[model samples]
Target: MKLPINESGLAASQLIYGCMGLGGGWNRDPIQSEHITQAHEVVELALENGINMFDHADIYAFGKAETVFGQVLKEKPTLRENMILQSKLGIRFPDEEKGLPARYDFSKSYILDSVDGILSRLNIDYLDVLLLHRPDVLMDSREVAEAFHQLKSSGKVRYFGVSNMSAGQIRLLQNNCNEKLIVNQLEMSLDKIGWLETGVHVNQVAARDNVLPEGTLEYCQLENIQLQAWGSLAKGIYTGRDLENAGENVKNTALLVQRFAEEKQVSQEAIVLAWLMKHPAAIQPVIGTTNLARIQGCVEALKVTLSRDEWYTLYVSSRGVSLP
Candidate 1:
């Protein structure tokens, strides 16, 4: 199944390689030569594994992630043509010296300036897509619209999207922006089942417990907004993480995942990811693993397709609740 992003004329990959794990660790330290070497390995591995869409954020590793990535671009300028590069903005960390608390910023100047920083750090002329990292409660749609207009007109960004936004939030912003919002990324995984529970528990007493932004699933689907799943691996809980302190449900789910992996003759990562992909939303899993072996395991997901019964069994096991 093709991603909804393809409709926008950008040939994005089925899976996205999240850059959160790059640039060594999230610190204020300078990017070392080793970091650049690691970035090269990750970029090459991802391309070999069929992931050409790279995801990044301005705050990842205090901007060193983009810096190391920029080194990769410096080495291989030709990679610009084959890759679809995406990055996010709007999340500002605390600055005690400036007496500013951590906050989300969508102001026009912040938006425009953030894009420039992103481009300069990544050594790119423009972004394939730029997402508002998270909703800024005080955001002004007109200011955002104006910033997007400038970016689009100047070719700074080709597409716009959001992360961790609700349906109403997206609608409110979309109502004012001239550009189409083509992506909505949220935390979705076997461990994070709120998105699925919102639909399944409808009209039931358990519905009240679901905190997923209402109508988000259906809204994104109807609007042709590609839904991207971050934390899609659930921190490896269902794959090979130590379950000694895990709850009964998670342990059981891990065992079940192992069973499926054994029966299907694929890696555990394949089973865990295939379950999320089984959703009709065509959700693209953003894998953040930097381990070369684990990266190979994640790519195995593209080969497996779960039957309906298999999907439900895994879902129910992970939720630790019977369907009402």
Candidate 2:
């Protein structure tokens, strides 16, 4: 269940526990002590199940999620050495500034200032990794490289990566940075199958109409960049659906997932996630559920390996049409 982070020779759990759900809500609500307890329970469950990497972002619950996680670290400082902590920055919510809209900011100053805020909120001096949450169209690769250099030199961050970025964008940033970009996080799941569809439909008329950015998956595999999947379960469409309320395709997919789960003696969630892990790129599914049972169920995916036919069945069922 361990995957290499890069050539750094360091490895982390194949399943990452996303901290977005740790905080009670996604607004500007004040973090409560109960939130700390909830985070502690979830963190303990993840660690107990061999998940050592925790993912976070500055905007998760408007920063309350990081605060709750930080409180857990404060109460149990020894746990820090047992985990890899990663957080993201560069997403800015709309503020009081006149005529300003919610946007991304990868400017050197914003990146630097955001890291400090993340550290202060998390009560940590350093992060195992820091990801630029999203692409800022106005970003200057040179400025990003400078920020990365300063963060690394100051011992504030150990590794750098990007989320929701294309291969070209990653190359643009990598060319200017001294450090290698180790990972790319994207929304990939059974239902959200564009990442797979584009490749499957290559050179065909259907491929021309595919919305996925071509070559991103292959590029990550070629460059040895880890692929982290954000919405790996597609919000429980494959595993948690009520067939009576679902459409024909969803109901059929759920039934197929159930059949596989029964045959393999695993949870439906494991079937859904294992299908993703079967890819050659070694995708790491980030599970954000706060439910302990669901977390344990997802961990079962580490043990369930789908056969090629089973994989294709699920893929075709999800696509609602045979591969072109």
Candidate 3:
């Protein structure tokens, strides 16, 4: 279940626990004792189940998630050495001083300040990896490179990567940076099939209309960037409202997932995640569930293997169309 993070030689669990839902909710609430207790339980469960990588972001629960997680580390000081911690930066919420809409900031000063805030909130000396949360249209690659250089040189961040960026955007940053970008996190699931559809529907009229940017998957694989899939379960399609009210295609796909789960004697969540893990790119699925049982159920994915025909069956059903 361990995978190498490119040439950095760092190994992380194939499954990453996402902490977006940890701090009581995604609002500006203060971190309560209950939040800390919940986070501690989730972290312990993840570690006991062989999941060592914990994903975080400065904006998750308005930073309370990291605050709660930091409290867990404080109470159990020895747990820090056993985990791979990664957090994201660069997403700026709207503030009164700016009086502007929320946007991304990749300036050297902003990057430096953001990392400092992350470290302070998490009560940690450094992050195993730091990811730029999103691509900023006004980003200066040189400035970002300078910030990265400072972070690496100061031992603040061990590795660097990005999330929700196109291949061209990643190239622009990687060209100027000394470190190789090792990971690109994107929304990929059985329901969110744009990443797969674009590849399958190539060279025809359908290909041009694909919403997914072309060549991103191929580019990441070719460059040895580990593609981490966010929303990997598609929000429990079988149990979600999409199954009850959606068209036949959506329902059929959900039914197939359920059938596969039953046949494999695993949870439907595992079937969905295993579908993504079956790809050749060695994609890692970030599980965001805070439910302990659901989190434990997700580990079944590591044991479920789909055949080539079964994989295509789920793919075409989720796409709501056959391969041309």
Q: How many residue pairs clash (N, CA or C atoms closer than 3 angstroms) in each of the candidate models, in the order given? A: 0, 0, 0
Model 1 TM-score is 0.98
The TM-score obtained by model 3 is 0.97
Clashing pairs for predicted structure model 2, backbone only: none
Deviation in Å, model 1, residue 200 alpha carbon: 1.6
Where in model 3 is the C-alpha error above 4 Å? 239-242
Worst window of 10 by summed lDDT in candidate 1: 1-10
lDDT of each: 0.92, 0.91, 0.91
Candidate 2 per-residue lDDT over residues 1-324, each given as its tens digit? 578888855579999999999788987677787888999999999999999999999999989999989999999999999999999999999877577789999999999999999999888999998999999999999999999999999999999999998889999999999988998999999888889888888888888776667999998889888999999988888787556776777878888999999999999899999999999888999999998899999999999989999999988888888767
Predicted candidate 1, C-alpha RMSD: 1.1
Look at candidate 3 and tell me the lDDT of residue 145.
Answer: 98
Q: Number of the top candidate by lDDT?
A: 1
**Model 1 lDDT on a 0 to 1 scale:** 0.92
Per-candidate TM equals 0.98, 0.97, 0.97
lDDT of 3 by residue, 1-324 (tens): 788889988889999999998989978767788999999999999999999999999999999988889989989979999899999999999888869879999999999999999998888999999999988999999999999999999999999999999899999999999988999999999888889878887887888877768899999999999899999978877534455578777899889988999899998888889999999999999999998999988998999999998999988887777778
